[model samples]
Target: MDLQISVFLLFILFTAGHSFRCYDCLGLTGSCANQTVQTCPSGFSQCQSLTVVIQVGSITYKTKAKDCAPFCQSGSINFGFMKVSYSCCNTDQCNAQDAPDPSNVPNGKTCYSCDDWSCSNTVSCSGTEDRCIKATWIAGGKSVKGCASKSICDVTAFSNFKGISCCEGNLCNCEGNLCNGAQSITQSFLFLCCSLLSYFLLH
Candidate 1:
């Protein structure tokens, strides 16, 4: 009877210590085609796939990432020239599928962007971007004006770029010569965190 009880307790402990497995990978554009399995850390509740696309003029940049995430809700954020989309699933290895491509259809909103010394250059807004943003950094003597989605515009921490302002309506970004300095730390942190997570999971 003691041996039987010991065996049952061992089984319980083994099940309790089990961790979820997820696919993990990271790459720029097409590099994520190959992925590896990873054991999720304790308390991580979901597997996630994230895709980011940035379009400037005729050039496009893309990134793909997958890892064990802490219960992230799936959604998309569009900032006129940039877009980020993410999907999460609770099942093991459910993040194997790729994220869908971002929509290219113009959303009918327009804003001003700076190129070289020109702040009057027009930028066509797409997706959920509905605000014109102007950010400037006094120390760096840099400024930028562009269209942003509600999510990106809502980020309050600009770090070195103290001059940050946003407005709704077409061509609102061209009203001022002083431009917004830097992108929000939140977006940078998001990308950095995902990169680190993928690195740790792979190594």
Candidate 2:
């Protein structure tokens, strides 16, 4: 009887310690107004909030998402085309607030960037974009190059881009100026938050 009682107490303690909850919602604008509380899965111990802003020519788009996450790191990333910011917390409903926008001020870093199918254009990096990124299609050989925030250079983040690679140093996307042509020896990760922006914009 004592063993049975101990087992019951242990289960109650474990269950109480593992439980977590967060707000879950996604919106096209800077914030989500209609969020619902959701119990997180066993391994999900953090509440996450993400904000993405993208610019194309004269227009700009913003997206926000909040949910329970297994793990999260608060940070921001800036690519020439888009900027993303994320915040995480361990308490219930802690992600109710929106993540802040990434800084727009130029950071004085530069890299080769693609413009209208041309990879020779120079682009000034801004905010947290301290690394250079190069992504090439395996079959087509077509490539895109630009500056990226270090947080977005995670391997798991660039998995969708396949041949995507990142490197450090100014104008280091390739060995020569305007030569975003060959793959460099160093490679790193990419954040898929950019893809999230694309998905939200498309659907």
Q: Candidate 2, residues 1-203: lDDT per residue as tens digits?
A: 99999999999999778668898888876668888998888788888887778777678888888888776667655545666677879997898887777777888988876543345667787777788888753323445577766665765334224466788888788646447434332221122334446543332
TM-score of each: 0.53, 0.66
Candidate 1, lDDT over the whole model: 0.64
> Model 2, residue 65: what's the lDDT?
81
Instruction: Show pairs that collide, candidate 1.
Output: 134-180, 135-179, 135-180, 135-181, 136-179, 136-180, 136-181
Candidate 2 global lDDT: 0.68
**Best model number under lDDT:** 2
Q: Per-residue lDDT of 1-203 in model 1, one digit per residue for the tens?
A: 99999999999999888789888987775457889999998788798887777665688777787888765546444444555566779997999986666556678988876554355567776666677777763333545566665654665423223466778988876553333423332234235334433432342
Q: Residue 167 of candidate 2: its Cα lDDT?
A: 87
Best TM-score among the predictions, by candidate number? 2
